[model samples]
Target: MAKELSVEDAEKKARELLDRRIASVRTLVTARQRLAELREQVADADREDVRLYNAALNDGWSPDELRKLGLSEPEKKARTRRRAAAKKTAADAPGVDHQEPAPVPAPEPS
Candidate 1:
């Protein structure tokens, strides 16, 4: 059997429980804030990774080489397709000249 609490003792216990609940809520909020910060850091790191990968690609580094260096491959963007489509549309439109310059003939061998 459990001992019965006096009115004062019961009220004190209730206040203690409420205080613990408030502390738990505060800790949860702090944890959430830290999680948000971590997510932002991860996003920033990913951007840097992509930027470096693209730079390496532009510098003639092979995908295999990058992989050997333990770097992740950057995702290909649809921008190239979009740009090609735009160019085609503009060239097909009236008043647009998309002709390539004529190549100069090589000099005859001596």
Candidate 2:
């Protein structure tokens, strides 16, 4: 026959389980944060590579050589869209006339 645990012993076991649960939750939170940081680092690296490729192009690097770096088409498209959005935002500045004027009709040529 097993002996029943005393109240004090039961309380201690409950506290221990609670502590373990708290530690597990903390570990899980830390792991999630680290994963997010790693993902951000990867994105930053990709942007850096794109910037470097642009610089090399300006410095007369061959397109074939740049292509060898494994930049995918989707990545290029995303970069293009990002650049266009940035330019649009900049052009839509406060107090600036954003609307284009109608094209002036040229005088009829003889």
Candidate 3:
């Protein structure tokens, strides 16, 4: 006859598996929160990168030399206006107030 698992043994096994799952989920949550924070930091760093690149260029550093040093040209920041204004863009709604243009005159016969 086969022996059945003891109650103590079953509790130990369940705790082991559930603990592992909890640890993994905790790690994932921590990583996702850190990833979001890092993204904001990276965006701030990009703006600073552009500023420093421009300063170096103004300091007489040649573009070719900078390229050889592996520092590529930084891109311009996209947000020229305030945050609220930037977010409130034209949402591709249809233009209902349409106006007709004047008709062109036909050429006289030669």
Which model scores highest in TM-score?
2
User: Relative to the true structure, how large is the alpha-carbon lDDT of every model?
Assistant: 0.86, 0.81, 0.87
Worst 10 residues of 2 by lDDT: 72-81
Candidate closer to the true structure by lDDT (higher is better), 1 or 3: 3
- Candidate 2 C-alpha lDDT tens digits along 6-90: 9999999999999999999999999999999999999898788788778888998677766677643226533343344445576
Cand. 1 Cα-lDDT? 0.86
Q: By TM-score, how accurate is candidate 1?
A: 0.53
Over 4 Å off, model 1: 1-11, 74-110
Kindly report which residue stretches of model 2 are placed more than 4 angstroms away from their true locations once superposed: 1-4, 68-74, 77-110
| Candidate 2 accuracy as TM-score | 0.55
Q: Which ten residues in a row have the lowest lDDT in candidate 3?
A: 84-93
lDDT of 3 at 84: 56
TM-score of each: 0.53, 0.55, 0.45
Among all candidates shown, the one with the greatest lDDT: 3
lDDT of 3 by residue, 1-110 (tens): 89999999999999999999999999999999999999999999997898899899999998899999998888765767655544433453466435567899999999
Tens digit per residue, CA lDDT, model 1, 1-110: 99988999999999999999999999999999999999999878878889888899999999999889987596654654434444456669788777988999999999
RMSD in Å for model 2: 16.8
Pairs that collide in candidate 1 are none
